[model samples]
Target: MAALTTDSAKTDPLIRITDLTFIYPGSVKPVLRQLNLDFHQGERVGIMAPNGSGKTTLFYLLMGLLKPDSGTIEIFGKPVRSEKEFENIRKRIGMLFQDSDDQLFSPTVLEDVAFGPLNLGKKPAEAKLIARDTLNQLGLEGFENRVTHKLSGGEKRLVSLATVLAMEPEVLLLDEPSNGLDEETKTRLITHLSDLDLSYMIISHDHDFLYELAQSNYTMKNGQLEPMERMHIHYHSHPHTSHRH
Candidate 1:
């Protein structure tokens, strides 16, 4: 896929990517090609695309999981030019991966949620307090000692988000948050996400979830990002519509 660029508003943008391109270690071609986009603070942006449309790749780039070949990625007005800069920016960005199993691998749910803060040098007790509070906020009170591996699919997904929330990141990156959730759980997830104050970028195939949680939309096709039209229907009406713009 060839890379492309689009113009962003002249106002201050929270993220800036200029001519970014990246190819996997052993792959012959780059997954993202000269991609450029700017996201503003406090915006709930939905990234919609078919499978392998570079949606996940874009998230990885923003999260510092993967480095770009020859472009600049700036976060919060700071340029990410090296691993150290990326590490610093990572502390301000929370991420929920596509697979719950990939994220929740600790012995207990509390341990998993505390991992981020612990790595940042907080005391064990303080980290536990943060984790417990986050879980309580998500209606998972009194489940701190629960074993992570024993959780159900939906439970694991919620636990994953709880872990990220404990970090109190300024930017939230969620990939396929509704993948394995039941209808009730999905509704609760939407409610929780809508109440968060952080800026967020989400990659999802479920249009209903996007409509309820996202104020703006973008799509990736052949390694390029195209801005999608803003949708303005009452999302609470049908609760299951997948209509796109």
Candidate 2:
């Protein structure tokens, strides 16, 4: 297993949000209020929030998909405020949406996975190679020619993740990544995620999944984020049995 990175080095944050506030159009209540966060390199951050608690809204604001009513968002030490500014940032921050259908639209699995690299200006062959490698990384070998819409819900979710990973982003924002997955698929997802070196913020309600991978965890409530106490988990492995407590 890869060693989890700690914030002991005192380096600048990879991404920062300060005094951020946002309210949806025509809505009086702000979904997010004075939100602040700092994400460091190689960190796995977990966010737990109930439905409609503004977790997804926070992600959109970070991606510049939704404009903040007030405050600032900085990525890679640069302030991002406009769509033009976010274009390059988007290349560095890959997001996996809550719904697989929202992310995958290509006819074949390979095309869907390769789309990001292709759009990033890689040649078709190079993009295809990246797509294949990403799929294999997620234990999806030989799924290249599979019909995108015909895949099972779990398969589609993994393929969606492959699409994001193909971009080789510096940061990842995963929303509800384990929503429709069974226990076996979820464990597979955790294993794959644990192997990656990239920094990511995962929004999940599954405590077990978050506990498995997140180095730091937070709870979102009333438009604010509060750090959660880290739970000490002990892992035990035996023949045909694996569990954590």
Candidate 3:
């Protein structure tokens, strides 16, 4: 597989949202309204906002699970006009929801992690190798045979990440990754996420995590994203701005 090179990558924005708006079925007010944003390759961005601020809805829209009422979305410089385009881009993007349980539905961790690559038509043995490698990368060496529901909350999250990691996506989106995690697990997760080189977009209210892991930060308020001066500031400068939140 080819890494997204800078020259070739620059020719196409990894994500482009222009005047995007979305309204759920039978809803009067638009959940997302006239949003404009752009994401380039190799950037780690943090999206911050309170609950009911359309954070999850934006994630769903980006994943192409929901279509906008009237607006434009481009993934990898290709126009997202139909389901075909979405299908093409979906393979390149991996998304993890707020709840790992939502993603870890397979009976066993190994089976769960292998599901994505298997669905992509890889042979079972090949998928198994990918799953095992991903599990090891996340420091889960022998829990592959364990039942997902039996694992601890943190372990389940790691399994969830392994599932997406097997797909080798160019872009990774994480929503509330630290939710329900213990201190040790949260630290481990932060360390693992820090080492990833792919383009990443993370939504969290955890200021410390964002300050440390994100190259840029955007706050979603009133259906728009505003960049604060602190986006370029070093992590130590803020001293955990989100601790009270």
Candidate 4:
């Protein structure tokens, strides 16, 4: 397994949020309120929240897909506000949506996996090579020519992951990656995810899966992102913050 990077340990935060707030238009109440969090290089942070708790909204804000009504977000110590700025930052950050169908469109699995690389300006041959290697990494060696629509639910998920991995992203934002997998497939997915050499923020309701990957955990409650455990231990900075019930 590759060693996770620690460049941000003695340097600065890779992602920072302060006093963030947002609400969907026409909604009576805000989905997030005064949220503050920091992510360092090569760390895995797991987030848990009930339905409609704004986990997806948080990811959208971080990616600048949705503009926050208040507060600021910073990536690599710089503020990202516009689509161009976020697009530049996105080169380093890859996102995997909850639904596999949302990501997979090509007829063949290999083509879908190579899509990101091709868009990044890699040569067709080079993109295919990257796609092939990513699939092999996920233990899907012979799936290159497989028809994506004919794949099983677990296979689709793995192929979706392969597409993201092919981009060689520095930061990964995964939302409910294990949603519909059986036990065996979930186990395999966990094993592969645990071996990646990068930072990630995973939002999932799978408590056991999250525990296996996260050094620490947080959850959204009443629009507040708080520590899941009573001790409120944070892995990034020392001096654990205060806990709230």
Query: Quick one: best lDDT, which candidate?
Result: 2
How good is model 1 by TM-score? 0.88
Model 1 spans with C-alpha error above 4 angstroms: 1-11, 231-245
lDDT of 1 by residue, 1-245 (tens): 12222334445678988888888889877778889888888888898888977889888888787878889888887778777888888888988999999999899999999999999899999999999999999999977999999998888999999999998899899999999799889988998998888899989988788888988888886677888876532334445456443
The full ranking of all candidates by TM-score, starting with the best, is 2, 3, 4, 1
Q: Which ten residues in a row have the lowest lDDT in candidate 3?
A: 231-240
- In model 1, what lDDT does residue 40 have? 86
- What 10-residue stretch in candidate 1 is worst by lDDT? 1-10
Provide the lowest-lDDT 10-residue window in model 2: 232-241
Q: Tens-digit lDDT track for model 3 on 1-245?
A: 25646554545678889988888898788878898888888989988878888888988888888888888988877778777888777788999988988999999999999999999999999999999999999999998899999999999888898898889999999999888888789889999998887899999888777877888888777777777567343335455665552
Question: What are the TM-scores, per candidate, against the unseen true structure?
Answer: 0.88, 0.91, 0.89, 0.89
In angstroms, give how far residue 74 of model 4 lies from its true place.
0.5
Candidate with best TM-score: 2
lDDT of 4 by residue, 1-245 (tens): 13323643556789989889998999979899888988888789989889999999999999989999998999998999999999988888989999999889999999999999999999999999999999999999999999999999999999999999899999999999989899899989899999999899999887667867887788998787887772343323434365321
Give each model's whole-structure lDDT: 0.86, 0.89, 0.85, 0.89
The superposed Cα distance between candidate 2 and the true structure at residue 211, in angstroms, equals 0.4
